[model samples]
Target: MTTYNLARYPERLAVVQLGPGSEVPSWAESSSVFSITATSTETSIICASRSVPAKTRHHRPYTAFAVVPDEGSADFDIASGVTGVLVALLTPLADAGVSVFALSTFGTDWILVHESDADRAEEAWRRSGHTVAPATPA
Candidate 1:
């Protein structure tokens, strides 16, 4: 198993579900670290919890983990690019019964779990032989 370096993001996030073809809300830009995914069925947004309006149909307070990889003399998990990284990452979480909301972008793959499960998420990854650490601001 390729070990992944996951950086835990500071801001708690939200996953907002909107109808298909819905315009990306400007509020989605509330955070630099967010993912907007549009599919045939719906437009799902993963953004800073504070950015989403209280009335939106959304799930909040998820803790985000970025597969930052490539620690240089460190490790490699960069890009939305990783072969089987998700399987490696998710399997343990699944075994641990942690529900995850995953997002992949040009930059990287994100794994979000309810804030209540943050510690368990970290433990799951660590126990799976991966490294989990606080994200360093870019």
Candidate 2:
């Protein structure tokens, strides 16, 4: 088994909505960013940021927010974070009856949990041998 150091940074997980006629805010727009396919019904968007965007992408229709740490670092979790260590992380959450929206960059992994499950999920990861910090509000 390999050990990993996880750094929980100060960040928030928020939801954004974009309706048929709505456009996303400039600040919210980024190439690495992803949005669920647009639908007539409300779509859920999970955003991780230090502060709430001034303008939310219009009519997200549905939104789910979580306490996202600024950023969490896990070493050798994947093939240089280019692949999907996140898939492995989320698999456990799913097995434990938790749903998560996960993202990863070249350096770290971010997991967005339902606000209700934040604490539970945090503890779960810690007990599973991953270093994790308590989620903090920003």
Candidate 3:
């Protein structure tokens, strides 16, 4: 098993896009924060993180994450590879002067970035041996 040092992991940022079109929503504000919790059909609670107002004229705010699954979790083996993948990706971004916010979960890691930073971050990741495809229309 590979050992990880959190401090050694590189940071990245990602933003959540709401609404449609390549253009950002004019009314979408990120300063406002709210969260939703729902009951799963399996009788479990699914809690969502609070989303802050995320839109700016030129840049959108995104949440960053470094996801690590719970100890002994069934998916830990696969999820563990994320750290190495992320670390490889982050080095170049830092060199390019990108700021990042990172978050982690039992299932996956999330990297939030300002909308302005997204394109560049993706480019850097691609150069660093990761395949980050553009987000398709939702």
Against the reference, the lDDT scores of all candidates come to 0.83, 0.50, 0.42
Which pairs clash in model 1? 69-77, 70-75, 70-76, 70-77, 71-74, 71-75
lDDT of 2 by residue, 3-32 (tens): 334444333446666566455544553222
RMSD of 1: 3.0
> Which candidate, 2 or 3, has the higher TM-score?
2
Q: Is candidate 1 or candidate 2 better by TM-score?
A: 1
Candidates ranked, most accurate by TM-score first: 1, 2, 3
Candidate order by decreasing lDDT: 1, 2, 3
Give the least accurate 10-residue stretch of model 1, judged by summed lDDT: 73-82
- Prediction 1 global C-alpha lDDT: 0.83
Count of backbone clashes for each model?
Answer: 6, 8, 27
Candidate 3 has an lDDT of: 0.42
> After best superposition, candidate 2 residue 134: deviation in angstroms?
5.4
Off by over 4 Å in 1: 71-82
Error of 1 at 107 (Å): 3.2
